[model samples]
Target: MKRISLCLLLTSFVITPFVQASNTESASLDHAQVTYVQATQSQNGSWCFNTQVHHNDQGWKHYADAWQVLDLQGNVLGERKLLHPHDNEQPFTRSLCNVQIKPDLQKVVIRAKCNDHGWGDKTVTVNLLSETGKGFKVTRNNK
Candidate 1:
């Protein structure tokens, strides 16, 4: 009886491992300043684009009218309007644009200018947001 009980106990313990569910790791990143996250891949699969911009400034009129888009190669793809009306006092602004994340891409850059004549321009760099890679942990990823 002792031998039979010992075998049963061991079998029960061994079976538990296979019964437990396995967790799958998500290919994603999360953060407070991650107001936006995109894992979009282009049809050609040449690059992966992930972008995040925040309006975290205070006491300032926006000084710039355009939002420049740059690829991992630092080439200017295009530029668009800041989207918000001229505001000099919007205590904060966040995520000026969404990113088209292509596959196999490595880096992306963007630029934003505050309306305040006294304030300098903002250049944001988002790196390694590609598949199988880690993204930025944003706190003030504001531009």
Candidate 2:
């Protein structure tokens, strides 16, 4: 009986960390998040951006529903709505094309929202001048 009890206690100690780690990983994904964003300008002067959103899309009930591009002033320039849950496709990239951006605007931000959790606090910013002049540089926003 003593050996059995010790074995059980050791097993729990070995397994508890794994269980907690799994739960933490799942909880992090449960919230809608923008992992990455890439912006590019087309020949016609319009802009296109690809945003990567990570979410624990369980179903219609919980999913990353949309992402948007906004100027510094918070004016929405373009939005891409996710029609369905990306349950299997965690951290997926979606693209918005032909976005009309003013030439005078220097920067833009990207954000995503989930059906259950509202908008995520994180955002990504792109420098239009660098993207247009030299090459595109993707910047991550933790806030």
lDDT of each: 0.42, 0.81
Q: Could you give candidate 2's per-residue lDDT for residues 65-95 as a string of tens digits?
A: 9999999999999999999999899889999
Q: Cα miss at 105, model 2 (Å)?
A: 0.6
TM-score of 2: 0.72
Query: Per-prediction RMSD in angstroms?
Result: 15.1, 9.6
Q: Which candidate ranks first by lDDT, i.e. highest?
A: 2
Tens digits of per-residue lDDT for model 1, 21-60: 2211111111002223333433443333344434433322
Cα lDDT of model 2 overall? 0.81
Scanning candidate 2 in windows of ten residues, the lowest lDDT window is 133-142
Model 2 misplaced regions, further than 4 Å: 1-27, 131-143
Model 1: per-residue Cα lDDT at residue 48: 31
